[model samples]
Structures are given as structure tokens and as C-alpha cells.
Target: MSKQLDESEIQRLAAYDIAHVVHPQFHRADHDGAVIYESGSGAVLRDVRGNEYIDGLSSLWNVAVGHGRRELADAAAEQMAQLAFSNGYTGYANLPSIRLTERLLGIVYPNMSGVFYANSGSEANDFAIKAARYFWYTSGQPAKTKIISRGEAYHGSTMAATAITGMAPFHKGFGPEPPDFIQVPTCYPYRCQWCAAKPGCTLECADAIERAIVEAGADTVAAVIAEPVHGAGGVIPPDPGYWPRLRQICDRHDVLLIADEVITGFGRTGRWFALEHWDVQPDILTIAKAVTSAYVPLSAFIASERVHRAILEAPADAKFMIGCTNSAHPTACAVALRNLQILEDEGLVERARVMGDRLNAGLARLRESPHVGDVRGLGLMAAVEVVQDVATRAPFPPSAGIGPKLARAMRDRGVVTRVKGESILFAPPLVVTEEQADRMVDVTGDAIDAVTKGQA
Candidate 1:
């Protein structure tokens, strides 16, 4: 076991992190002075200073079963002892990986016939994009290679996945996005820019996709990729009719649908997969994060039989050969299997639904506050959109830095969360209790009031 570090030691470690660690998706200047987290268990995390905070974002929307699970650690140790380093690249298979694939299929939708392994959500999405392009190539429709994602969508960090990501910040300094990846409007109802977005108004957000499909021409489009709930893009759940309409549009246009379930998969949204809430099935599905509860890196790119048949059943000479060295790592698969078992045995999915209601209700009460514009989410995944005026729905100028202010206040109050622009995101571990959920909501409300007291 590791001993607690003294103040001097913690300062030294923070300095080292500043000098050596290149934190992803963070402002370099901020990370240079960021807090150094030491360890965590259950829904709480401790910084190097030994201050505990409720893990509101589940440490990047993973850790579904919570932190420091001994069963998962034991599973990893046992698998490592038995066979830690088999190369799936050379057609060598390991027991844990084999079992993980079987287990995933048994729990996932029936159409997901095969699983391709990777190391992260980004890798899974990258592979899914490649698989879609390869599927079209093998089907003798090479021109059908364009992928349609929504504006403000986030896929992953890799070049191919980055190309699919619709968030402008991720692509700002990156060179031109890869060819044939197009972005359409998102089905975000909270801040919908298209129309009034009230009852009886047309779902122009969904219609925008069909328009993009027509503009690209059906034959030129390969797939429509989306997250069930746009997590990184402000936790915006889709309009009720959005996903089913997208599914119908994809089918009508012969475009494959790819659900990027990295954030919403594995009971985050009160369902095994967020798409299940709408009963909408995608041709390709990518999963990560909660797969191993973030204990071990593991991701899966699952394909329907149609996609599988198109690629795997191709002639040997025409097969698309692609894989990573860490694909199907036995130890990671073992940890993930154990994590899934815990999620099932503990009934965390149903728990997420029940407790999530409490979380959302508590958050909804905050809309009575002056700065709160909206409270929205499904299950444990949710957000509170902060604005200058709830009546006018006017967002505070980025110059106000309300997001950063609220984040700091919430941290001071012993709660950790993610602030995306004007939206404060909440995705606590599925295992979080109702009391913890209430605490998280209370902290969020206090943060909002403390930050927006004068302005609001």
C-alpha cells in the first residue's frame, strides 16, 4: 500500500505533473496549477491534500461501478498471472477475451453479431469509422464513404475519430479534418437554434439531418454517427422523436447508423445503452469507459450482422486488415468482465434509473434559482445549463467565466463536476446512493448561487 504524501511531497509531485504531464482536453496554463488527486473509492475522491469530494462526473463519465473495486483488481491479477500478454494480432486468443466477447453479445442487442476490441473509446470509434468505410468498399460502393456526424458531437481524440468529432474546440488547431466527414445540426432542444422548439413546433433538428443526407446524396454517405445523449457537448439529451427519426432516415437513405455509446453505455443513462431508451438500433455501436469501470482500458466496436457479413465475409484477398497491439488484451478483458458482473449483480442499472430520478428532481428544483436555464438528463447522466436570465434564456458571455467560477466553488464545497461552457454536467457513478445524489445536487445549487449571486 502507498503511504500518504506530506505537503512538501505533494507540492513536489504537483510540480512534476506540471513539468512532465500533458493533460488532455485541458488548458495548459490551468493544468500547470491544477490540483493533484491522490486516490478514490466509491463515489468520493481525495486530492493530494487529503480533501475528499464527491465524484460528480465519475472521473470522466466512466467508473460506473465506482472506484477501487477489489473484485476487479483481483480479476486483473488472476488474468495477468495466467496469460497477460497474448498477441491477438497473430490470431492467438486468450480465455478472458473470448469470454468477454461472448458476454458482451449476450447482454447487447441481438443484431450486434461480432465485437472488435480496442484500448479506448476513441479507438473503438476510429475502428467503427474504418469498419463503415471498409464495409462500403467491400460492398462495391466505394463512393459511399462520407460520414455524417452532428455539430458539437464528440467521438474521440485520434485523427480518424477526431475527424468524426463535431466539437470545434477539438479541431481548432488540428489540421483539416479528414475528407468526407460532414457535420449536421444536433437535436439539442435546450438551446435549439433552429426554431421556437416548443410543443407543436417541427423537429427541424431531425429534419436537418435528412437535408444533409440529400445534399450529400444518399449514395455518397456511408453512415450517420451520434451519441445517444451528447455528453461532452453539454449533456444534451435528444428530442424524443430525434433518434427514431434518424434511424428511419438512415434506413431510407441506405446510410448505416453508428451510435457512439462511449459515454452513455453500460448503465450510465439508466439503460445498458442509451439508444435502448428509444428502441433504436444502430448498424455500428462503439463502447468504452464503463466497460472496465475505467479500472483497465478496454473498448469494443460492435457491428450488426449486415456490417459483419460485408467485411468478414469478404474474399480473403479483399479483406480489410486492421487492429491494435493491445486489442483484446486479456487482463483488460478480465477486468471488464468482472466489472460487468458487478454492475449486473448489484442491479446498478435499475438503481441508476431510481436514484437518477432523485438526482434530476433535486437538480430541477435548482431551476427556481435565477441563473439556472435548464435541468435535463436521463438516469444518472444530467446537466444544469447556467444563463444570465432564465426568463430570457440569455447565456452569460464567455468572458464572465461563470463555468470556471461554479466549478471552483463546487470543488470547495467537496463536490467534483465537469463544466462545459455554460453547462454543468453531472454523471455520478451508477452505484451512487440517493443520499449522495442529494448531496451532489445540493452542492451544485450552492455553487450556482454563490457564483451568480450578484449578476443574477
Candidate 2:
């Protein structure tokens, strides 16, 4: 049961938040006046006003096992009572973290042998970038330091991670990015740049990475980074041939491949890891978000045996040092361990596949909608791209704020979702039931109709 707050208490908290809390990636004015979401269970959240909403985006793409799992809470409690915190610095290790690492290795790709802990997906990627560069520098290839990412990629928000991030809006207000963080075209079949010159997608987007490496001199490129499915970049999954081609290109150039599995790992995409969809093996796989199901902030940087061996063989003085205070936090690891157990024990990964098929089929049926330009996604992570002219694929003006309007309509209809530019994306909890999915789809379609009636 959730604690019910009086109206005055809710108002007081809202006032305090407006005065002190600086929300990330949110409109301050709107957030200041927003409803206070107090608690959640299953796939539903309840605001202070007691209005219930479907956890449509899975609380920012986390919460895979859904809300309010007592087992996870108990796991955290036990770890906290035994040993709350431990420094994971050199020469220091905790039993929970060690066990967590062993368990993770048992589940990750066959070649991945080691894991580095961090507090969030951003830190994991930051560590990965440093590790990749350090691996080359110590191997006597100091010039191989550049990392090739793709446009529209969402790596992280840290300075180094932001530089590698392909979104322009995230870079705004920040000064010039660091050098050697280059970006190539992404595998977006709906809007492929190569399709203009060629009739169809030649997987030229995948070829672009090789072109970027060669153009920059492959000796100067350390690795190529990408998400198996571009999550925040509007849930854009790559072409079927993209990942294999990327592996081949990286092999040809001797550049490492980094899969930012922050959003797609841990069964969000039906598979334990999205790379399994294409049998592509990345040298380093960065994972977070659902690792602990957001019960606690935790992320893991899983490195392949090949990369681990090189790092291990480096000169003793050449240490690849990068970490956070909460890195390998014992409680976080314990929570994550239990979370993974729940995910596997309950067969949630397979659930994601079944529910995802249902969700996509529902969204695909909405193609009859005048404003729906594209419907694309894999597993439970999906999106419905809104447009002003579907025939021309002309996007609605950002000034119109159609996405937000549609989201508001859904909210009023008892659903929560994310609005990214012209796309309304969905990544509901893996435990979401068929009835809940039906409600989500029904509300979404009605919301689109109600909001875009005249415009469409």
C-alpha cells in the first residue's frame, strides 16, 4: 500500500521541487506543475491524486520486471544490513560484486569474460571509451584512439560520452566536443540517406562506418560504437544485415566493436541481449537501465576475452583507471542479481517477445491512421512516427508540439508514454499483460485521433 498524501502536503512538495530540483531533459515550468506520482505496482502508477496510469515507457525504459517486487526489495535490504557499502577501488572487492560479476559472465556473450561496474549507463559507456582507447595506447598503437559512433545515437550524457553521442540537441549549450569522436550515418531504413542515390537501402549506412574509418585512417580509429536498436533515437532497429556487416568492417579495420546495450540489454528486446538477434559479437557491451530494473542505479561494462587479455597483458604501470564512487556498490549488485533471477525465473524475456508481437501488430494496424508515417521497432521497444503528410513523409513542425499534445491525450486516457520529436515511443514493462497492452494500444490510437484530427 502507498502512503496517501494530503493535498497540502502534495502542494508543499511541489513547491519545494519547483524551487530546488532541476529536472534533466524536462520543461521546468511543466514539471513544476506536474502530478506527483507516488507509487506503482505491476505496470500501473498512481499519482498523488490517485489517478492510475499504465507504465507505458517502463519508467524511462527501465523497470523490466515491473514495479513493486518484494523479492528485489528484500535482496537490497539483506545486502544493506550485512555490508552496505564497499570501495571497489584497486585491492578492494566485495562478495556481492564478485558473485554478481560471475553470474553476469555466465549470462552474457560467450566471448565476454570480464565486467566493470558503474552507477549508470552513462558511466559504463564512459569507462568503455577510456578502456578502448587505453587498450590501443598500451598496445603501442597510441594513434588508434578515435571512436566511430553513428548520428542519432544516444550513448550517454557525460562529457566524453556526450562527445560520442550523435544527437545535436544534447550537445547544445556545451562547448566544442573533444577531438576524434567521429559520427557516421545510422541504419535508419525509414529515412536512409543512401536511398536517395540508390533505389533501396544497400546497408550503405553500415558501410559508412568503414568509410569513416578509412577516411580517418583506420590506424587512428580505436572502435565503432552503436546500440543494437537505437532506443532514444526513436526506437530505430538496424537493418537485418547491418550488425554482421559492422562486425566484418571492424574486423577488417582491426577496430573494436562496442554495443551500447544500455536500453536493449536484459531482455528488453526479447533476447537477453539485442546482439543475439543478428549473432554479432561486440568487443565491449555496455549495459544498464534494466540491469537492476531501476531498483538501484547500476550498469556493467562487459568486455570480450580478447579485449580483456590485451588489457591484462598491458604494462603494470599502464593502468586503465576510470570509475565512480558507487561503482560495484554491493547493495546495487545484490539487487541486480535478484532482478536478473526474477527476469529469468519468470520467463520475462520470452514474455517481451510475445507481448511485443501483439504491441507491434496493434501499432501496425494504426497505419490506416492519416498521421502515422512509420511503425517500427523490435520486441517491446517500439514507436509510431507521426507526420503531417504520410504520402510525402513530411514531419509535423516541432513548433506544433503535436507529440506532447498526443501524449497529454493519452495521459488523460490513463496511459503514460514518451514523446520524441514526431514519434510516440513505447517500451512497456515486460510483465505487461495482454489486456494492459490492448488498453495501451486503444488509448494510443484514440489519443492520436483526438489530438491530430484537424491537422492530419
Candidate 3:
């Protein structure tokens, strides 16, 4: 067991964090009261104060094999002792990276021919954008430069990825929006403006992408990027027909489809990859987060055979001019190989499917509450949307601060997860037990009742 921090030490560290750490999505008020996590094992985390809480969001939806895995540590140490680092530049190569590439290609879409490594999802996505443009530039269609993304999408925080992200808040204070990035309507079934009143889905959301492609001129659009199941913006799973239609539209326009699977990849959504749920494939796929279970920083953008061939055939000068310093860090690759082995050997992908059903079933009972407007998810990923009025699906005003209130309430009850706007997202580790899954829903229900009891 690891040594525990004393009370004074904890307070000192918290103060240091407030003074130094520049957190992501930082808010000064929230940072002041931040809980200092010290250790985690399986689906539970222990704070410096030693209070345990269910890791409902898998620490930002990454730790798929769960926390405190000695196997991964051993793998990393073994690789580092053998060969810590290697230049993955053009001429040099490493064994672990090459082996991982082979393993990933075998499991990912059959069309994928190669992988380019990066350190984070943002970098992987930026590379995807660049690769898409490069493909068209070399194919005698230099004008194909624009990238279309859907509203409510969260690609990453990099400048190029930020422009591709459709959420308005991400663009605030970031100067004028970057050019050549277009936004279209999202396929959010609950809040879909196009078909909310209709008897059923008109799939007008998919048609909107087609409209955007035409409006931009097909020759100017290089690709259409999207998440298989939208995370962060909300746990909004696209309608069954949505992805297939989007794939058809991209093909019709000769636009490369880039699936940002940073959150949905590696068995988070039942299957090995969420796109497999729809039988649709993307030309370029950007993945991170669960790749190494966040053991170390690693990510990659994969290219389909068609896209790889185009870059390969390009002249030496135009030869996909992009590379990262840690392109294929051998240590990270070894850890990832071991992580993939654990995922496969333990059958966590199918386990996510099983536990996801249990989780959804538990959350389904929350529909009885007046504030619970929607419960939707795929596999182990789910969300409970709180509403001001159930009949109209009206959201609470921002000033009401319902999301933070509910988040605090759940945290106090030993259940911690993401509460974005009116959506309460739940994506526990695949190793979660039925009991832990039940606690997530039960605590959420109790929190909703406690927070919204007398509200009109």
C-alpha cells in the first residue's frame, strides 16, 4: 500500500495546485475547492482525505482497464530498461511501435493501412485534418481544403481541432474563428429541431451535412469529421441511420470521413470501435485516451489504404510533411501492447456491453422523476438529462446552476462523474461490478431528488 498524506500535507499541496496548476476547462471558483485524489484501484478513487468514490466517468473516460494495474507498470518498466526511447523519424524505427501498428491495424477497420503516432487526441485530430487536406492536394484537387463538423461536437483543444469543434464556448476568447471549418446541425434525437415534432426521424440532420457540402462546393470540402457517439458536448448517441447516411453523403461528395474516436474507441461503446456498431467505416480515424488506458501519453491517427496510397504516391516534396518528436515512443507502445492484451484477454469489450445494459436499465428507472427528461446511451456510456419541464423538454437556466448542484450532490454521496449543462454523463470503467453500476444510478437518483425537490 502507498503511504498516505497527512492533513497538513494535503492542504499544502492543494494550495500549491491553486498557485501553479493550470487545469483544463479551468474555473477559478471550482479550482479553489478541488478534491485532491491520491490513489485509485479498479472503479474507485480515494482522495487525500481517504474518502472513496465510484469513478463514474473513468477519470475523463480513459482508464478502461481500471486503475492500479501492476501489469501495465511492469510492461513499461521492462520496455524502458530494454530501450527507453528511439527516434521514430523517417530512417529510424522501433520494434514495439511496429508491432503495435500491426496489432491495431488487425483490429481496426480492414481498410486502414498505417498509423501515425502523436501524444494526445488533439494532436491526432490535427494530424487527421492535415492528412485529409494533403490527400486532396496531391489528388489534383488542391481546392479541397474545408472541413465540416457538426454542432455540439468536441474534437480537441488544438487550434486546428478547436476550429473543427462545433461548440461555441470552445471558440470564445480564441480570436476570430479559423477559416475553412464549417459547422452543421447535430443529430441529437432529443433536441433535434428538424424532426422533434415529426412522427419519426426524417434524418434531416444527415441531410443537413449534405446541404453543407453543397453550400461549400464539394470540390472545396476535404472531409467531414464526427464522433461515433458524441461525448463531452453530451452523451448523445447518433440515430441508428445517422452514421450510414453520413458515410454515403461523404462518399457522394468525395469527402474523406474522419471519425474522432478518441472517446468512443477501444471498447467504450460495447464493440472494439463504435463505428463497428453501424458497419460504416471512416477514411481517417483519430484515437487516444483508452489506447494505453491513459497509462502514458499516446495517440495516433490511422489512414485508410486509399488515403495512404495517395500520400505514398505524392512527389518527394509533398510527401505528407508532418512528424512529431514522440512519433512512436517505444515505452508508450509497449504499455499499449500490454493494455490491448489485457482488454482482449479479459473480454472487457463484451463486458462493457453487458454492464452498459445494467447501467441503462438502472438509469431508465429515473424517468419517473419530473426532472429526468431523458436517459440514453450505448454500451457502457450513458447520460441522464435534467430538465426544468419534462413536457417541453425545457432546460434549466444557466443561472439556476443545476448541473453543478447535482454534481456536488452526487460527489457528496460517493459518486463522481461529469455533469455538463443539463446532461449528467456516466461512463464507468469496464471493470465495474453490477453493484458499483447500481450505486451510480441510485446515487444519481437520490442526488436529483435532493437537488430538485421543491423547484417549480
TM-score per candidate:
0.97, 0.97, 0.98
Alpha-carbon lDDT, every model: 0.88, 0.89, 0.93
Which has the better TM-score: candidate 1, or candidate 3? 3
Judging by lDDT, tell me the better candidate of 1 and 2: 2
Candidate No. with top lDDT: 3
Q: What TM-score does model 1 achieve against the real structure? A: 0.97
TM-score of 3: 0.98
Put down candidate 3 lDDT per residue, 102-202, tens digits, no spaces. 99998999999979999999999999999999999899999999999989999999999999888888989997777999999899889899987776788
**What lDDT would candidate 1 get against the real structure?**
0.88
What TM-score, to 2 decimals, does candidate 2 have? 0.97
In model 3, residue pairs whose N, Cα or C atoms come closer than 3 Å (at least 3 residues apart or on different chains), thus clashing, are none
Candidate 2's C-alpha runs over 4 A off are 1-3, 196-200, 454-456
Candidates sorted by TM-score, descending order?
3, 1, 2
Query: Candidate 3 at residue 155, lDDT?
Result: 92
Clashes per candidate (backbone, < 3 Å)? 0, 0, 0
Candidate 2 lDDT, 31-125, residue by residue in tens: 75676788899999898888899999998899999998999999999999999797888889999899999889988899998799998888899
Cα shift from native, residue 446, model 3 (Å): 0.4
